[model samples]
Target chain A: MTKNILLSAKGLSKSFGGIKAVNNATIELKSGSITGLIGPNGAGKTTLFNLLANFYTPDRGEVIFASKPIHQLPTHKIARQGMVRTFQVARVLSRLSVLENMLLAPQKQTGENIIKVWLDRKTIKKEEKLNREKAMSILESVGLDSKAKDYAGALSGGQRKLLEIARTLMSDPKLILLDEPAAGVNPTLINQICDHIVNWNKAGISFLIIEHNMDVIMSLCDRIWVLAEGSNLADGTPEEIQNNPHVLEAYLGQ
Target chain B: MLNFIINLSNNSGYIVSLTILTSVFAIFALGLNLQWGFSGLINFGHIAFMTIGAYTTVMLSLSGVPLIVAVIIGAGLAALLGFFIGISTLRLREDYLAIVTIGVSELVRLVANNEEWLTRGVQGVRRYQIPFVDWEPGILGKVIAIALLTGIAIFAQWQLLRGIKNQFKEYRSVQNKSYQPTKPIVCIIWGAIATIVILFIYINGIISLYNYHYQAGLMVLALLILALVYSGLEILVRSPWGRVIKAIREDEEIARALGKNVFFYKLQAFMLGGAIAGVAGSFYAWQLNAVYPTSFEPLQTFNAWIIVVVGGAGNNPGTILGAIIFWTYDAVTRFLLPQLGIDNARLSALRIMVIGLILMILVMWRPQGILGKKEELTLGK
Candidate 1:
């Protein structure tokens, strides 16, 4: 069955000081699908993610999101177009409260403007109340509603990852590029994260995840793409990729 | 007691002058707080904004621009410079901003020092007209006016505490459930005590208002400007825009990832801070009745930084307290050193040594500052 592509990257390449971090990497995220990108260490999975999100400009090739070219847009602009990315280390603002971290996700807030922040107090307050409600509800869903007022830095490593995922939901993102959501997380929270991802996918959001936990990638991914040495190796159904000799060799070589 | 009152009143001019100077530095420190305290932008050359503000206001007004218009333009020009500087440097690492700002400040001072055609060079621009010059009330009238203004200020302080208490009512209730009285209760008590002290001073007639009305008027003007700028900043830092800046300060990369225009926000903060410094500069020029390139040394910028650090970075009230503490220490040291028979050069060195000692102690004992919250510091543990 064919699925509509929510995001696609073609011929993306990036280099740092004579080292090709990512070379001619091509991938796509289909709508309402949980796609997995797996690679050995230094296989350029994160570089690909950076290029797709416009965090780094590609030396070659282009990215299209929601049927528009996005290579020229800023990372935030790409995010505003319903594509959001999370860091592997869970980059929550450590000093901000959990709820504030959530509130920071929404785009185009009227209160973000200097003049409107002063003059449109009524509207800004109303919008803030609504955003707070939204953040709280999302936090409740993730079992973090009680810790909403706590500084994000105080959260356990697993909780910080959960908070990052929860924060992305605040933007009402159509596609989420999650970099290692399960890395360093305990087993129980990892299970919880997988369940949340599945539920979110069922509810119509697409995910492009870079993860090393084979169990997570195997169980959650509808399709899996493998990268080796800064280039695409193979992409297929989880079972097909599991049996593919080339994919096996890439892992063995690493 | 009467003799003491009479003696103090005889020196009212000196007291008022000291207060006016403190108020000016307080305004400068407040601007620094907005940038370094809230936004975590390291502006090492903040004095440049003050220099531009002072020079522009004086030059423009001298060339026949209206006083108010000139002041606004001066602030606007400072803000414009800040905007450009932020654009060129905000994207880089934090230390770059510090280096650039310090360099920029030196460059501005040098320009003012050499550009005789513009700034009048070493001689400085003196005898510039201050606002409300035509409305000078006589000595007795000025005294009464200052007393009234002090009363109003105390009342305003009380009201401000009450408003803060109301805003934190929920948190106080939560804290009460945990067996703590509301913190604002202490604040209210302090406000009450302050009001009573002012009343005591008025009833005792300890300080005569005679021959000091002009100074009193300047004091009132300084207070008014402080109230305006402080309130504006208070409102701003509490707004969503303020939150964004705080987030940027915490981590610009995360802020950008969350779709905030980090550059834009940083630039805005830089400019607003510069504009505030510019306002302080105008008041400073009024206090000195002159603008000289030498007056804007890097030491003045360090003084503002010390005020912010000692009062507590990120705490507005702390900034004011820091300014008062700083200027009082300065005045007291100057007076005491002379009385102690310290020669001029030695006296200056001793004064600096005392300030340095105080700063060292403060940094060691209360690095977060006198009023700063632990979590609010950029270097949170």
Candidate 2:
């Protein structure tokens, strides 16, 4: 059986000033698959994610998600279509409660409409209760339920990463693009995060992760794409990427 | 009790007008709080909305539109102005919005100054009708007013009770964390004292209804509107719609990633804030019985800013407290400075310097303002 493509970007290129930050990069994420993007610094891995999410309009390319062209859509509209991205640094709303950070994830909330907040009180209340419960359960799954009332800023670095991933769960996302999930995390927490990602993938959510940890990338990813100096260098399985001389030369500098 | 109220009200004109002015500015600052405080939109041209509101209402009333309808239309015009400005500038960086707003405010004031036919130029617009000017309420109307006042009093008491209960819950949560017992105890005492003061005011307001004067009636209406706007904002800031704007405030990118329409939410907040400021302008015109170009100066926008900052930007009740404190300072100094033998010109200048000093001290000592939470401070972000 052939798997369907969930997200596909074709010949995406972005230039800033005189530099080509992301030069003709293309990647495809199959439905319910875990894919890894690895690149040396300044390789434009994050910029490619921005292009895929439409946070930056690529100078030239088309992105199709869930069989619909999304390169022209606004970032929020693209997110609303069941695809969301996390930052290289966890960008949580520090002023709001952890629960509020989670509650903000679910798309199309009735209470989000100002008029309905007053006029549709019954429905809003019900929706809020349901969303709260869902948020709590997701938090509990990640062992963050106790901190629900605490400010998101109060969470530790690893916990904030966890919170960011858990927040995406509330949005019912079909595909999640994590910029870096284990950058500042400890070794133990990194393993835990990888376990959570595997569990979530098994639960039918697709992931496109940008990680530098070879262990994380090799163990969690079904396939890998490598970039160097803002261009795609190689694409292969974990063993193939490990053996690729071009990728080795790019990282090791001859 | 009636004799006491009569005596108090015999000399109440100054106090009544002062209270009305405070209420009007409180409403104005509340609008700014929703924009800058909660939504993090720096609306440096807030007074522009008030000017539009005042002028539109007065002009329409002069042309025979009903007073209430005129007020609504004025607010709508302010919101429309906000929409036009927002569409043009909200997509830019935050500082750009600030610059554009200040420029637009100046533009608005200049137009009011230049349009001789529409606004009578520097002569200003006057002779518009004030609401309840002929409120010689019959026995039935008087009774209804008393009942309404009593109902609001009861509602206020209930809110106070709820506040105490919430305080209790907070105390419980912090019980094991080396909490200071005196803090909540002092708060409870203050709440009790305030409840008593409100009861006294309710009775005084009822007695004054029997002696019905237009200025007093205006005071009552102004306070009523302020209360309604206050509670409405309280509800809004706690809603999910408010949550999205707040999220936008913290990081629009994060809100956008979470599927919130960041620009739309910003525009909504800006327009709604302008509408509220417009309502405040209508009240201001009614309070003064006239509208003048000088009254809508850029200084008024800064006055609202001071109120929001001193009261705690994100806190609604704090904004009202800031307005009351501000006006009290102004009123007290107006009388006190003359006794110190200062002439009028220097006295006015000295008054501003003192306010500046107080603000500087307050910000240095308690950067979050009186009611603002330390954790919620968005400054320096």
Using DockQ as the measure, which candidate wins? Answer: 2
The runs of at least 3 residues in candidate 1 whose Cα sits more than 4 Å from the true structure, single-residue gaps closed, are: A1-3, B1-8, B138-156, B159-212, B377-381
Q: In terms of docking quality, how is candidate 1 classified?
A: acceptable
Could you give candidate 2's per-residue lDDT for residues B1-381 as a string of tens digits?
778767867756666678789989999999999999999999999999999999999999999999999999999999999999999999999899999999999999999999988888898887779988877888898787777777777876787677667767776674543222226886688677758656755666765677777776777888788888988888888889989989999999999988999999999999999999999999999988867789999999999999999989898978987887888898899888899999999999999999999999999897888767766764222
Evaluate all candidate structures by whole-model CA lDDT and list the values in order. Answer: 0.85, 0.88
Enumerate residue pairs that collide in model 2.
none
lDDT of 1 at A22: 96
DockQ for candidate 2, please give it: 0.60
TM-score of chain B of 1: 0.87
- The TM-scores, chain A only, for the candidates as listed are 0.97, 0.98
Candidate 1 similarity to native, TM-score: 0.92
Q: Where is model 2 more than 4 Å wrong at Cα? A: A1-3, B1-7, B174-182, B189-193, B196-201, B378-381
